[model samples]
Target: MANDKNNGQDNLRNAKASASNMYEEGKAGASKMYEEGKASASNMYDEGKDRVNQVYEQGKEKAEEIYKQTKEKASEIYEESMKKVSEAQENLKEYSDELVKTVKEKPLTSLLIAGGIGFIISALLKK
Candidate 1:
């Protein structure tokens, strides 16, 4: 009975040691898995940030290009409008000068024309 008790004690000790070793191995494996998962998450976050930055840069460049084009078109339109206004002013001046010359060259004709225009206007106003 003494020898049997000693064998039983030795068996119990071996089982405890085996259980401890298994526990340590499981803890190590869990720690390694946690580290790997953290590293993967960090890498994914960096990649996403880089992609967003690239998209932002592309948008900025496109916006600048559009702004430049719009400004150039506006300038062209403004210059064209100014040119047309200048031409209209010159034509009006030429017409006024011609009318003055005609009035000076033929005083009787201009007087008759003026009287006729006045009579027509008065007739229209009466209606």
Candidate 2:
């Protein structure tokens, strides 16, 4: 009877040790799973950040291109306006010279014509 009790006690001790080992193994597996999840989350964040930066660079480049085009168009408009102004000045100068020549050729006649135009314009305005 004594030997049988001793054997039963040894078997119980072995079973307890096996249970403790199994608990430790389960805890280690849970820790490993947590670490892997954290690594995956960090990788996803980095990838998202990189994509956003790429998109920002593309947008910046596009804006610069549009700005260049606008500047070029403005310069062209300014040049065209300046050319038209120069042409108008030349036309005014030519008309002035013609008027001066006509006045010099017929000074007395031109004075009479000017007085007659002023009288007619004043009479019309009064009516």
Candidate 3:
């Protein structure tokens, strides 16, 4: 009976040592997993930040290009409008000169034509 009792005590001690070893191994595995997860999260965050920066640069470049194109087009349109205004002014001056010459050559006829135009405009305004 003493021998059996000793054997039971030895079995209990072996079981306790095995349980302790398994507990230590579980802690080590959990620590390794935690480190791995942290590293993965850090790497993902860096990659995402880089992508955002890259997209921002691309958008900025595109907007600048669009602004340049719009400015160039506006400049061209302004120049064209100025040229047309200058031509219209020159033509109006020439017409006025011709009209003045005609009036000088035929003063009575010009006066009669002006009276007729004024009468027609006044009649229209009354209506």
Steric clash pairs (candidate 1) = none
Tens digits of per-residue lDDT for model 2 on 10-121?
9999899999999999999999999999999999999999999999999999999999999999999999999999999999999999989999999999999999999999
- Ranking 1 against 2 by lDDT, winner: 1
Order of candidates by TM-score, top first?
3, 1, 2
Number of clashing pairs, model 2? Answer: 0
Model 1 C-alpha lDDT per residue in residues 1-127, reported as the tens digit of each score = 9999999999999999999999999999999999999999999999999999999999999999999999999999999999999999999999999999999999999999999999999999999
- Cα lDDT, model 2, residue 49: 97
- lDDT scores of the candidates, listed in order: 0.99, 0.97, 0.99
Model 3 weakest lDDT span, ten residues long: 14-23
Candidate 2: regions farther than 4 A off: 1-19, 108-127
Runs off by more than 4 Å, candidate 3: none
**How close to the true structure is residue 67 of candidate 3, measured as C-alpha lDDT?**
100
What lDDT would candidate 2 get against the real structure? 0.97
